[model samples]
Target: MKSAPRSAVLHRMVMPGHTCPYGLKARHLLRSRGYEVEDHHLATREETDRFKAEHGVATTPQTFIDGVRIGGYDDLRRFFGLRVADPSATTYRPVIALFAMTALMAMAAGYAADGTVLSIRAGEWFVAFSMCALALLKLQNVEKFATMFLNYDLLAARWVPYARIYPFAEGLAGVLMVAGALHWVSVPVALFIGTIGAASVFKAVYLDRRELKCACVGGDSNVPLGFVSLTENLMMIAMAIWMLLAYGM
Candidate 1:
């Protein structure tokens, strides 16, 4: 008779009030991957600490396959050839989620104000929300965003400080637009940055034919440096124009 496959040991945190989320994830992953899991639940904080110390590991959700340590959840992912280990892999998911959230907010705002899911006010709100969201993303890691922006932003390439100031400018514009105050400041700023951005994106992605990541969503983004970048600039331009036309001058 053939012997059954050996089980993998999964030692994870399970305390009185809280259980580690990654531990649950690791357990599920192991079971879903057809490994019989020998789940070892750390019942208390002291037990969890002791387990970590005894295993010479720093985190919970440690896995052991055939007596060889597989580290934590990320390590288990690596062992199974999953995509969790890579930090620099390009993907559009972040930008997609951001834009999706923006759309949802815009729709809700529109409906709340006008009893419809789409309207001019909603459009305005959407642009303002997008500016804030994108600014926040950049502000999360300004250094990273600046490094990426320098790759294609003509102004940032020429003046290093421009990269650092860009997020603040975007955030200020977003706040002013949202408040419906200081149009003079917001409009000019939006037009200035949007026009420069449009030209730079066009030159770098179209004229130069260079494939690069967009810093529109942030420095760590995997968003492609083409349509999405262009769209961002164009939206800003359109919003500026709309605000000007709506309020005059």
Candidate 2:
């Protein structure tokens, strides 16, 4: 006879005004993974708290397989040979999302400006928008960004203030480019930072072979230091050169 399918017991919070989305996700995961789930919904806050206290577990949406606790969603993923939960784990997802959104926004702006998406204007908008997005990420926590930047940036390591001011400079350049004004300010700023950033990334990642997290997305980002970081600097350099050639600055 064939063996019965494995069954799981899932205890999840479904209290009034507090439906745990993870609980639904866990249930979906269980069903998708070929597990018969016995979902135990805690319908009230008091009941949820009592369950947690009784079980000595910190959070809800807990799962059990074969009478052995498999933990929450992250734990369930691990139990099934999926990704493990580590808060500081490095990932490129955030940077990818930011860049993707920037591109889309630039495309939209291009269409709005002249009803054309395949023009040189679109490319300029893309680079300008990308700079703004990156600057915003760094500005979220300047202190944290500065700390991470110091790990690789030559000027930041020597002069701490440069790290603090980097985001503002990048943002200003981006805004000026977007407006098609103030080439005197934006051109120099973009060229200066771009040159320094490219050199720093190259020396640290290519020459020294140092493995480190990029501070481009944010100070607490998991984005690795390499191609993406180098690309951002290169884009700025290219944009600066393009602008100079166009306006003779």
Candidate 3:
């Protein structure tokens, strides 16, 4: 004996002629879940409610599968015959995580450099020539030598030693300090050096505030350092100690 096959009904109230956005969303959702059923779109809201009532369906997108009812969109998804999108597949990696970190460290070092200078802000500009201390200690590290001449205003961005401009200047200052000529030229030297230093730091801070990049040392080494504090003072002190020995000779 062959029994009558059970029929499943799908009731929708979507307007006709206008593509059902919900139906489209549902299509994608169902397809993702391996559901290959065709959707039913209603021409009007009234017709959809009427169909629901007649079929004892409770909501929109109401599914009667093999004569069993499922509620709404969410319910349909749970009975999904499709796979879900992988959350991990959409995640991303940080682009500038390491770069920003390294640049930040440079900024910190720059700040410390400025601070140490001002702590021993000597009125006598001649103290700068004391940088001759480098030769005495035989410290040939480019960065350490450059630190002696770090004038933020001059070196923060626009200028770099293409052929040892700073090294030459440091040597000149060292010679003058050694011969005691720096004492006579102390005012002008101090004014020049301090002005350059103050400007350099300010420029770095300004660029940092404006998010501008620094181009120092013929490279793109932009970083920020605020006002000079105890850091630069210590640098000056170290230079001064060396100058005392340099001058003694």
* lDDT of each residue in 32-101, candidate 2, tens digit only: 9999999999999889889899889999899999999989889898888987657888888887898899
TM-score of model number 3: 0.27
Q: Rank the candidates by TM-score, best first.
A: 2, 1, 3
Q: After TM-score superposition, what is the CA distance of residue 49 in candidate 2 from its true location, in Å?
A: 5.6
Pairs of residues at least 3 apart in sequence or in different chains that clash in candidate 1: none
Top candidate on lDDT is 2
Across 143-212, the per-residue lDDT of candidate 1 in tens digits comes to: 9999999999989889999999988998899889988899999998888888888999999999999999
For residues 97-145, write the lDDT of model 3, one tens digit per residue: 3224434443444456574322332322333433443222223455543
Better of 1 and 3 by TM-score: 1
- Candidate 1 is scored at a TM of 0.77
Q: Any runs in candidate 1 off by more than 4 Å, and if so which?
A: 1-8, 12-21, 31-36, 41-86
Deviation (Å) of 77 in candidate 3: 1.5
Model 2 misplacement above 4 A:
1-8, 14-21, 28-50, 56-58, 65-68, 78-86
Q: Candidate 2 vs candidate 3: which has greater TM-score?
A: 2
User: What's the TM-score of every candidate structure?
Assistant: 0.77, 0.83, 0.27
Which candidate has the highest TM-score of all?
2
